[model samples]
Target: MPSPTAFQPVATAMPDNVRILSFEVGHGECTLVEFISERQVAFRCLLDAGRVLPAALLDHLKSNPRPESPDLDVVVLSHVDNDHQGGLPGLLEAGISFREYLSPCLPAFKRLRWLFGERVNRAVDRAFAFEQQLRSHKVAVQYPLEGFKSRYASSRVTLSIISPAARLIKTLASGSPERVSALVSNSPTPLQWLFEVDEPVNEDSQALAAVFDGRVTVCPEDFDTFLPGPPGPPASSLAQQHSQGDPDFFGNATLNDTSLIVVLDILLDGVHRKRLLFPGDQENWTYVAAQHPAGLGIDVMKAPHHGGRVYLRDKDEDLPGVYAWLRPKTVIVSANGQYDLPRASFRDVLRTVGGSLLCAHQRTFEALSAGAMKQPTATSCFQSMGCDRGRGRSVTVTLTADSESADLPACVQGSGITGLAPIVVLRQDVTVPSEGLLRYTYGELDRHATWIKDRLDEARREFLNKLKKTRTAFDAITEQPLTSWRVLAALAKADGRHDLVADPDPVLKFARSQHVFWCAPVTGYRASPESFASLPAAADFNAARRWLKSIPSLLLIVESGNRFPTGTARVEILQHADWGVFDHLLAGKLKHPAPVIADEVRPVLLPLIAADYSFRLCHFNYPDSHYDGGKAFLLLQRDSVVIPDLLSPEWQVAWDWHAHGSPFKAPWKILAKLASEQMLAGTYLQTPYGRDALFNRFKPSTTTPLPAAMHKARWVTY
Candidate 1:
């Protein structure tokens, strides 16, 4: 949350010929490739839609004037992996059409299993469904088989299928039901599927090559299996030493090895200018090097398998996965913490080889903070290499046939060690505070702070005015409500204020006053078993210790009876910090040490409200309503918890909460909203009162050289 010492605005240098946008789709893959000619879009190709479509891509499609016609020139489903092709259905649903749809065909039985009520692979199911939909729309669908070629007249671009040799397709057509059943029986988890050595569907993935002018880019959609024949005549390239590995390879290849290996090259007068490679989740580098020696030593490469490490034969013999002997200058990882991807080994290898990294998702930072990855270096690798965990951030790589170098954003460039892209704040400028307390520093943001304070005042005044103007009534109808009464009893036990059980009206009065409404839990009607289903039964409390791990402060209310006569109720409040003593009590899991007296229901009512939970109560004045007098209405609202740690990833979460108007204290949500608006307007860094104002309010300080735990959680300024 710092700006560069000196702001030097530089226009993004995009190549005229080709542009690639690798989306941040959270452990999925979705890329858009645009072929531009004379500043006009000659063709648009979508490479491997991710598990979900990125909003940017959807917006791009919707922006097309020709909704009735094909807006996209090509859609390449790298393989049937759900992460790669799941978004295709969404694209089809959006009414976006493409002239050509290239993918490997699933075996007939595999595609038809869904119809017979069998649990088919989700990837296969989606692919088959999409194919049917495309055919219905009169779109041309073709398998990207080896030696298959197509030429586009308008773009003068030639397309060629360079992978999944005809033999591999035939092997797939002869379904491996026995192998599939064995794998299914093994019950490999989703994460295990990525490393499974014998995932047949991935073996049949397509690798596509595109040629326009003097530039060529190959997209291998997870096609990493090496057959016993020549794929085709290898293209010409520089003779370079392949990455070294054990020559005697004996282990089965991972599903990652099935990744489509694709290369990008620029040539003028048959002279190689630039060479880049994009190995899709591939880990078997020894075989790829032996097969395609011409495309070694890439200038840029998207680290395969979301930057996962590869085990050659055994876990002890693990190697950095994406290195695969084809080291590149810049490595981009498109993944998140969901799968614990973009591993630390990837970072160590990059540092050793002097390569830069660009991470697309912020959750990667969370993984680092959670100790899922470890790095032992002087300065943080995330800072030096450049990372963008910013909201909706994506990495764009542009290449031109004329230039020998590909263009990357300044933040993620390979040339210099410029810490972060355009932000640099000295660590000495920060202030660290004790836990659970936040210190806000205004500095240059005095005016903004004052404005915010005034806005808070105005908002409070407005709320009071609305309260005075509205006619509201509360009827606590607590008759025949045993479940809710049990829940309230559990809540009382959890708060360690069981004395309130005998007199619960004080809690109701406190709730009606709205002083603690900021953190109070809001219920639609009344707390019920169905509403809090995850809560264990109160009788199971002692046995459900694991479920009591982390419980938030809450308010429980039981309302019952008819509307005409008003309602009767009982209310209780529970509060805890760090560790909750009776977290599982409300789940109906509390174990009583002694037997209870069935007929001893002494539910006393209190006239006075506790000072900790309530403020002065105000009466509602309604001239038109008959039920507006004396009846106290229990109005509960949800509030955002204040996160005192600036380095914590919760700042991003708080930002998101503020987006949908999650109720929070005045200045907190207001600051978030203002920061978001400024960022969207492209003025967060340009103005005097920039986003630093918002961050300053939440900023917690640490030492100059942040410890491992703090480093991962926070991005340092300088």
Candidate 2:
């Protein structure tokens, strides 16, 4: 038996340098920092673990062993938001130990409970559970204070807490915890409970809330009244409605505003240094910007709130001030399409502020590997030791003290680091299949067939195992079978698979029928095989033809193979009797003038035309042919165009004579001309450059023949 191929490690050698790795966890932030000493001793610090521990981070933990013990130097849970701290439980379960755990939530939980009232006890309880987990792992837990600094004496790496002032905590704790509890108990409804705890605190919290309010547009008016207690009837009405649906919205925002913003300064041999500013979901940028320490320029900035639009002020005034203070050259954001982040507006703002945007979720390891192969020096660390493995997106940066500042790559420069090499590593798996048909033809055929059968059996077992897991998960979610199916259908749709509704299984069919109003067809067409199968034979034939044309023609061709042309011809005969059967048959179906249709339908149509009219469509080099025409028509339609210059006096006569004077006028010429017009129209409609040029040339004149010649030229020879 052949050994299973192993995935090559992208980076093997660990140099005595400073490096940062940002993992893509879908609308979350997870960063790992490594400081290696001259003697190769290393200290690792993690900043948040995102909502889930990505497969790549877990792989990293398994692959990279610590010199002394399998432990991280520090783990900073910057905030208690699910996106930031949700992966902690999984990391601990994986036996990845940490020396110190730092977070503001652990120490300020008591005060946070008082500010939010007893109704927010669920969030508070989760935080307490997290703290207990850290303690169970024998990790040192510390609360970040304003001006609190932790220094790794050996490596000269210092992390300084710069936000959530001590006074802020005191202000939040000013109201009596017992008074809030009593108010919660006596409240008529959960909505009233919030109003009861709306007693005013210090001016700092109010100012922070005011700053946040100006930025976040969708925050309910009730949340504002509940926090600052501005007397208004509209607020009361909103509070009543919101309490029935989402009561904890304001509490979540308040928790984010109190995130521990930190500045990490790394010094190499006392002279060479680098700084990173990690503001974990801190939306109160105005307050943080005002308190910004002078002479603190950041090399890289992990943008707050996953580059959310809410962090940017209405007029772009606050962001510029913040950027001016920190002067970050590279802004890293961790986001995915699911969350609609980081916002395009925020990215534009970053670009305007002269900062390069590097999104973690957009970079894949396979792409990085290809990039490394093309530019070895620029992406030197991206070399794979065996094929890459993981399901995450990540960007890695390696900085060396000895490397000359002038010799640094553009990426390193963009990140504001003077002497660094940046390498982006993504989580991907590369597999190489076996080649050579000789082995299969010889004695290996039987063995190969048996091996394939065994593999299929294994796959079936694995699929069944997965189904079992799904069933268990569904059972845990709900007791009712129909409810489980509906929930699963919704989850599947959210994951971008709408075909689940079309499954032939009785359960899925029932689920689809029940949710037919909400569950639209994935391909924008309503007809399906099951639907057609249930119809009468006479109606089914018509429905089937419509369904065939509605789907992608390429899919039909691939699925039916040689049967496609016959099937399509039968449908074509039923649809049209004359006017060049195939052309007329496709005209109505591909009427949209969509390039996608042309691209898919043309390749299959061309071959069918050639096969059906063998004598009429003989190769160009054949003895009977007058013009150079075979598959050349394909090229003419796609590449060559009848520009206005060709229709001018210098070339028109020659072209006309050459085209019309042919002994046998080519049938392909008509097809080619139609294809060209379709191609041009598609291009003009799809592209801005083509559209602009087309509109610019649209002048009102009877003698103007250029537009017709360029876009609507007819084949006179055919």
Clash count for each candidate, listed in order shown: 24, 4
lDDT of 1 by residue, 50-77 (tens): 8888888888666644434457887877
TM-scores vs. true structure, each candidate: 0.40, 0.42
Model 2, runs deviating above 4 Å = 1-16, 39-41, 110-121, 153-155, 176-245, 293-295, 310-317, 363-392, 402-718
Q: Encode model 2's per-residue lDDT on 94-186: one tens digit a residue.
A: 878778888763433443443343334455566568877777667777766567787884648898887665544433433344433332222
- Per TM-score, the best of the predicted structures is 2
Report the alpha-carbon TM-score of model 2 versus the true structure. 0.42
- TM-score, candidate 1, is 0.40
List per-prediction Cα lDDT, in the order shown.
0.40, 0.46
lDDT of 1: 0.40
Clashes of 1: 24
